[model samples]
Target chain A: MAQVTLRKLVKMYDEVQAVRGIDLDIADKEFIVLVGPSGCGKSTTLRMIAGLEEINSGDIAIGGHIVNDVPPKDRDIAMVFQNYALYPHMNVYENMSFGLKLKRTPKDVIDGRVKQAAQILDITELLDRKPKQLSGGQRQRVAMGRAIVRDPKVFLFDEPLSNLDAKLRVQMRTEIKKVHQKVRTTTVYVTHDQVEAMTLADRVVVMNAGLIEQVGTPNELYHTPATKFVAGFIGSPAMNFLKCSLEQAAGALRVRVSDTLSFPVPADRTQRYTPHVGKANLLLGLRPEHITETRRHTEPNQHDFDMKIDVVEPMGMETLVYFSVGGVELCGRVNPNAGAAEATSMKLLADLNNMHLIDDATGKVL
Target chain B: MTDTAIRAGAAGPKYGSMSRDRRWALRWSYFFLVLFAIFFLTPPIYMFITSLKTSAEISAEINPWWVFNPTLGNYIELLTQDTFLRFFRNSAIVSILVVTITMAISVVAAFALARMKFWGSATLATGVFLTYLIPETLLFIPLFKMFAWVNETLGIQLMNNWWTMIILYPTLTVPFCTWIMIGYFASIPKELDEAALIDGATWTQTLTKIFIPVALPGIIAATIFAFTVSWAQFLYPLAFTTSTSELVLPVGIVTTLIKGDVFNWGQIMAGALLGAAPPLIIYAFLMDYYIAGLTAGATKG
Candidate 1:
């Protein structure tokens, strides 16, 4: 029953504010991933929760106890670092059993816990070997195994898979997910890769420049981003945003791209966008998949337009077609058999039902 | 001629000449290596050969490199002398005690300066390294006067005691050893300590359980440096302590083996060679760790 709650957490390093006041309530047994670009304060927030960093002014409670002033050891939390900070002098068994030994757990119980963790992490055969002797993936397992043996209230991971090669990273991502399932502890993971966050987290907290942009389940964050930053940062091949204006022409609200093209606002969104009818510098945000080639199964609200193809990237199942609208380079997915080619014109569809209208000045979705 | 034959004829002598140049280069390298070996090994070898000779053979101009009589008289006599035994014991005690004290102070100070950043930690780290640059020769004068003042005011004699070397040697060793250890501790990823802190270990426990074990090579390197500095230090003992029973090895050997205008060459050579043995054996066994410790900061930082 270890539900970690962070209230108005702030961290400052000298003059730079790394983590602004952030408040988050993590449910017990929920695996939450705090993700952002580099230097976005996700790692700082996680460290504050782990008691590794001093909270400038805040309250961090784990299992209903305020631990802002408590030391990390007394907080009963374990962290797995990105570099797998294993004691190079000790063998795997000794590394895993270190915390238990420090707590003065009896020899037999320490042995039992270490062996059990080794069995769970599937590192039984490598107990006698030192950390230097293990491979990168093996060392990562040992690091997690060390955390598992303690059975702490919370497990904080600071980009634990950033060091591995891409293939090993994906494999370890699944391994971490399995470990979380078995242990069911309140886990807070930090990573820059959104794919890892989307795949492994039960809920994802998207942070940017010392503040969280949005927090929701992966599906919710993907489908309904609260801010323009969240929409642009949460997906790969990123969301393409076009600068335009919302104007009233012919007694109807429309997204005026230029003199040549205009997309009528969907009837469902007209009421929300009616207040900002004559506003210029409006940003139209759409994911790549949402701006695909016009198809028979395309929704009724999707608007089709002609675009000049700048480049065609063939990705086997689907081809990424790059085009330009209002001087903004936009990406749209098309069937590889759609005959999309460079230096040619192609008909692409922008699904207005799923399109996002953001005010450029405030960067907030309307 | 065929094209193959023409090419083979053109390339054959050039290939032969390249190998000839390589052979000469190898020969020159080995030649210099041997020259360096003889140049460095001669003094120690001459000392050993002289230690084996009798008083007559040393003064007689028999070959300087060879021992004609080959006797253990100097070894036997020095080993039996209570004063010589006392000097040996004092040197051993001072060195071991100094190494212990130096390691303790350096390890803790280095960890603080390296890992824990306070307001002036960076400046203080640079200050520590700069202190190592202040030669012991300049400080020993003030140190000598301070000891004199202590004896006069407090009535406790810190000078002229064998244990005084233990106190004075760390002044020379701790700065450099601390700098080396600071480099080592800094090179370790900051994550290891944080992980230990989160895993139910205090800062002291982190140092003892994590930093100490992980930085074993650095600690061994610092120990070897402290031991060698204490064992072979000549200037401080010469300036501070003058008592017969209180002198360390370097000053003890030189002062005792030479009887004003009369040098005991056999005993002097034997004593110097024996005193050099401890450091030499340590170097031979742990040269790799020593070099690693010395270069760890420069390369890593």
Candidate 2:
């Protein structure tokens, strides 16, 4: 395992810059994930690190050597593509052993590696089968087997779980995690799925519009997103963004979440953001699960808002109640037994104490 | 097949006359097959029949559609003639040489254009494919003049010989073969090359080991096209080579088999039939591969 450092790595296709400039330092044996939407340049960054694409301006140093001119083979990195990229012409054993054969390793070594990988993946029976003959999950394992047989310095995965069905995706996700844990190889994986990012990454690099918005542990990003985009993207059902203004009320400050609802700002955050109160147009961010029935809330975590419930989605353990605050639809998770009767108005408790404030114009965290 | 059968079963009860409709469909299919067979087979059949008839019988005009007094004399005469044999040999040599040369250049050029992404690669690829559309008829005149100039300046006569076709047929074959190969190569997934690249295979190794084996059908079709074009090239051979010894099959057949007012109609048909055999045989056996190569783009990206 080796550390990978990308210094101002930029990828430009003529005038359209896919990745403007990204800087990252991945520690040895770290399972770093680059997570973003389509066109966010996460895959491009990963490809550049893998030597699959040329960097426009910058340097990538893997294990303390600047490998700007290295080809993929010379870079000693193995990549697993989104499509699995298993050679359709070869059987599983040949596919897994391809790299070692190309490297001119001894026949016995190649055979041993292939056999070991096949046994580890529980795919020994599939050794003679072609990629087309295998199921999607089996193909994914073969792709991994191909990577591992090389014993490369780094492993690169570009949406490797995307092509499989839902159940297979989860199964492969865990398999990949276990593989990384067992091998402890420095790896860089790219995926657009936030749930996958959250569960699979040691540290997630959240990208937006070809720029790195935030990079932290999954829990850090989910519990305290650094920007409006990160907050919205890192959560399922997304964080609700409501336009609000700060106003002085009772000698302190209040966040006016809507025309009819306003909550007094918590004592701790007022000093940090309300210096220009009553004038600043702020964005109030609340994740879906943060808002719930008052009965489920304890003292310091509760703030009530009278709202007109729009939709109630009864997800087995909890009900997702969608309502409007300041003309924007907001979702709040509640216990299923809350009996959040359909289409009626109700008082909802938002953990306003933990709410995030972002600059309305810039989407910057306040 | 299964999809059609299942759909037909689903529609059977509603239609009420499924078996009757199928029988009529089969009858119509047979009727069209007969019509098409007559349309396609009549010319070759007539040529074969006429080839077996003697010159005297052809001249008598007993029945235009019927052959009488059939004999193999025309075939015997043509085979015995030294000039006809020379023409046959020259055509065979020229076509085989051209096919070999064309396939070599076209295959490498196609591999470069399809897989390699060097500087100016995309523009060069477009330009290469576009060159195929420049007609051979337009190119031949300048080429003829250039050959004459070469003979005048360099003291070497490249024209009035069958070997000149070895040089010219590549112009016709390379671009088209290369274009077809590019389409065929592009139809293969890019991921295959990536897999090969990571597998530590160089571009050449990957091409020979992985792509060439996979794209054999395309190579076969291109080879057949190249060979057929070289063998059947009448305009270039006729325009350049005029002497009896230098003449190829097509021109030799017309010149020697027809003398001023009289035509050796039987031998002419026999020579035409013989000349058409090789390509017909190649296509008959590998028709699926030829169609597969042509329809690669339609079936794949």
Candidate 3:
């Protein structure tokens, strides 16, 4: 039972803080992914957990034991690098068995574990081939096999799939998820790709500027982002934000986006949003999928408005329509057959049930 | 003429000119290649020819380059002579010892400088290569004096000893070998060692098992460099060792075979050919690795 914990973890290179003070608790058997844009400290945090980087001032505990001074090998952790750092001279079997041999594990036990890992990764046929003889995907499997043969407390992957081609990357994503389901080892995977994070992680840790923006399950982060950064980062066609102000209209709060466009706050959030009525620096944050073509039957708080489409992108199953709202460009997803063409007007529905009101001044979602 | 014949005649001159240009280029390339080959190979061929000739026929001068009557007398005499055998033995021992010592010190030093960087490591790495640039011609004088001082102060003879070459040769070979190895070691991705560290291998184990094998080509190149440098070196052995029994091949053959206006041309050629054999055989076998290691150092890191 190896649950990793970090308390006030900080890393500094010269005067630059690569990782700011952060606290986290990773439960046993949990698969956590740290993801963000480049230089957001995700890779640095993973390296620190692997004991490859020194903590500037913090405590890292694995299985409830402080491992601040423990070396990487003694931490009982395995890391798969981006480049698949397999021994070029060693065959796949020897590569998998290197760690065990280093620990002086018995020959038969090492053999059994390697063969078992090769079977698990479905690389048994490649046991005799050297690393150079393997394809890129096959080499990636051998790297993972090398890590799995150790059966360590935690598996640390440092952007292990970043080197594969696009199609191979998606294929390996499912392969990784399947392996995690079978092995059930606590894993920490880092990547800048949000889709990989959402698909592979049990919970995603969204980081920005050396600080974690939010941590939650994929659906939680997508539907209810706590910060503007998280909302913008977690989706493919990112959530759109339009400059607006909340105004009190009779007993309801209306989010006024422009002279002709305004959305009434959903009834469920009226109480929470009433205090912020007439507040300046307000933004209407809504996802592209929430604003779509007017449906046959409208649900509660769904408002219909006409938008002159500025651009159109037909993406096979869905069409992305772009239009101007208060001088800010906004995107909406409609059915591909809805005929979203550039320079054309279409009646679109704005679903306020999924709308987010953000305080642009502090970048907080209210 | 027929229509096809007229078309073929019109196109022939243009196509024929291109082929003529290519043929001339090929002829000139081979011309210089053979010229350079003969220029470089003539001396060795002449040495082999002289080694096969008797001293009487060599002096007759009927045709200096040709052997009127060839004999194995020179080879047989040198092989039987205890002094010549001793010179061969001394050269072999010195070269083998220097190569071993040079590799041991340089491999570890290069690994430390390239991977396990510390304070001033970059400057020190550059400093090592700079030391190699300080030609041995300049340092040999100082080194000769140092050995002299050691002899006077300790009452132990440092001069006229073949074993002293073992200590002196590494000063020349280690710096350059370490420089070559530093390039090779630096070219290996940093993730490799980090992976090894997480795999439970200590620094020593990583160097022995992972690095040494991966850099084997560089090691072979450095070994050849060390072996060749020490085997053919002339100035240090001549300056330091004087006695007949205390000489290596280059110094031994020159000092003994050419005594006071009388030169043993046949025996000298035979000795020179035999002395050249070991390095020739090593290069012949490991030439590809030697070239790879050399170019990798320049291009990789």
Candidate 4:
């Protein structure tokens, strides 16, 4: 059991800093995913923790002891590389047993550990075949098997599923979760794909540029995002942003978009956000599902837009209607039976109760 | 009417001459390949023909290409001669010793240079490869004088013997062998080493268990190159060893096969043919390794 911690971790490659002062505490048996776009320093952070990379300037503690000077071997960490760095010359049984052999583990014990790891990965039948003889998925399983047999304190995966095809990636994604269930090793998994992060991580660390933008449970990142980048990055198809201003009318705060749409702020947030009224240009953030289609004209139209529908995408179960507001195109999911058509004028009901108000200057939830 | 229809169909000028150009391209490839084969094979084929001739027929006014009176008398004479066999034995010993020494030094040096990433590593590696480009002829005079100084000052004579080559051939073989091995070791993905490290392997364990096995092809290529280079070496052996027994294959044949000022052409060619056999046989069997070792770094660059 290992709880890994990084305090003020920093990595600078020449002048470009890849990881800038990342501090995190990964608890025992927790599957944490460091997710971001390419070059977001997620993988660099993982490598630093694995001791594969020299910690440029930081303290790394594993299981309550400072392990900054420990080499990867002494750290008791097993890393699965993106390319599945399985020794191509060795068969699966030998591959799984290689680390134990290096440690001079007894022959019978080595055999037993390898057999157990192979069984866990469902690769027992492929124990005698070289990596080249195995398919891509099988090679991946052997790579994981190599790590599993070691029974390492921590498992470091640097995008292990990135090399597999789409169907295999999804299948292996679940298989990885199952492996974690069996072993319960504190795994530091890295990937740029957010879906993998969402589906697999106990806690997702969203990184941008070189800093941790936010860290929380997957549900927290989806429901409530701390920054504009996180808000836009976490969800599928992304949240749409419209430029608007906050104004007061008859002592009630309302967000006005051009002169077309006006959304009233609830009483609880009025005092907190009323100081910079009119001058405070706030971004109106709304997820696609919250934007709905209204029938004809409705009474008490507090949230409404006369959006011209440009493309209608009907996904049998639901229709995704695309329309433009002040030259910014936005997508909304509607019931397929609602008869959402393309190239027609449509009235959209902005679901104000479910709507999120984001400060335009700083992308924070209002 | 036919001319008008043809003109209408032939709207573009490029299509008409394209097929003609392709035919010439094909013809040129065949022409050069055959030319290359002849240019390369002529010397060895001529040597074989001369080796088969009797002494009288070799000196007679006969076509250079033909063995007029076919005989293996030259081969039998060289094989039976004690001094001639000594020359072959010396050549074989020097080359084998040098191959073993070069590979031992090169594999270690290559591993360190390629993977260790110490100070001035890149510059030192480039220097090693560059040392190979400096011809042995250029270093021969310096090396000869150095040996003479060692004999005078340190009281150990290294010149004029087969052992001299044991020291010098490694100088020739190690740098080139190391450079090729470096290329081979570098082609092994860094991930393999990383995995090995996490598997509780010290750097040495990783080098032996993983890197060596993965880089075996490169090792074989380097060994073949070292062997071929050491076996065929002429300049060092010729300059250093003059005694009949100490003379290696190349100089041995030239010195002994001449009587006074008269050249024994048939016996000389026979000795030459025999001397070339080991390397030729090795190359024929392991040509794939030889060629791959030479070109493995091209993919790297």
Off by over 4 Å in 3: B1-32, B55-65, B288-301
lDDT, model 4, position A160: 92
Tell me how far the alpha carbon of residue B181 in candidate 4 is from the true structure, in angstroms, after superposition.
Answer: 1.6
lDDT of 2 by residue, B244-275 (tens): 88988888899888999888899999999888
Task: Give the per-residue lDDT of model 2 (tens digit) for A1-366.
Answer: 489999998999899999988899999999999999999999999989888788899999999999999988898899998887776667889889878887899999898988888877889999998777777788889889999889889999999988788998998899999998888899999999999999999999999888999999999998888888998898898888888888886777788876678877778787887665765668888788779887643676468766779999998989999887656888999889888977898878878777998886787888
Shift of residue A266 alpha carbon in model 2, Å: 3.8
lDDT of 4 by residue, B116-177 (tens): 99999999999999999999889999998899999999998787878889999999999999
Which 10 residues in a row give candidate 1 chain B its minimum summed lDDT?
A: B292-301
The candidate maximizing lDDT is: 3
- What interface Cα RMSD is found for model 1? 5.7
lDDT of 1 by residue, A17-67 (tens): 999898899999999999999999999998888877889998899999999
Candidate 3: the clashing residue pairs are: none
In model 2, which residue pairs have backbone atoms overlapping below 3 Å?
Answer: none
Better of 1 and 3 by DockQ: 1
> Which run of 10 residues does model 3 chain B get worst, by summed lDDT?
B292-301
Candidate with better lDDT, 1 vs 3? 3
Candidate 1 Cα misplacement greater than 4 A, ranges: A296-298, B1-29, B288-301
DockQ each: 0.42, 0.30, 0.38, 0.37
- Model 4 lDDT per residue over A278-317, tens place: 7665777788877778756644433666777899998887
When just chain B is superposed on the true chain B, each candidate scores a TM-score of 0.89, 0.88, 0.89, 0.87
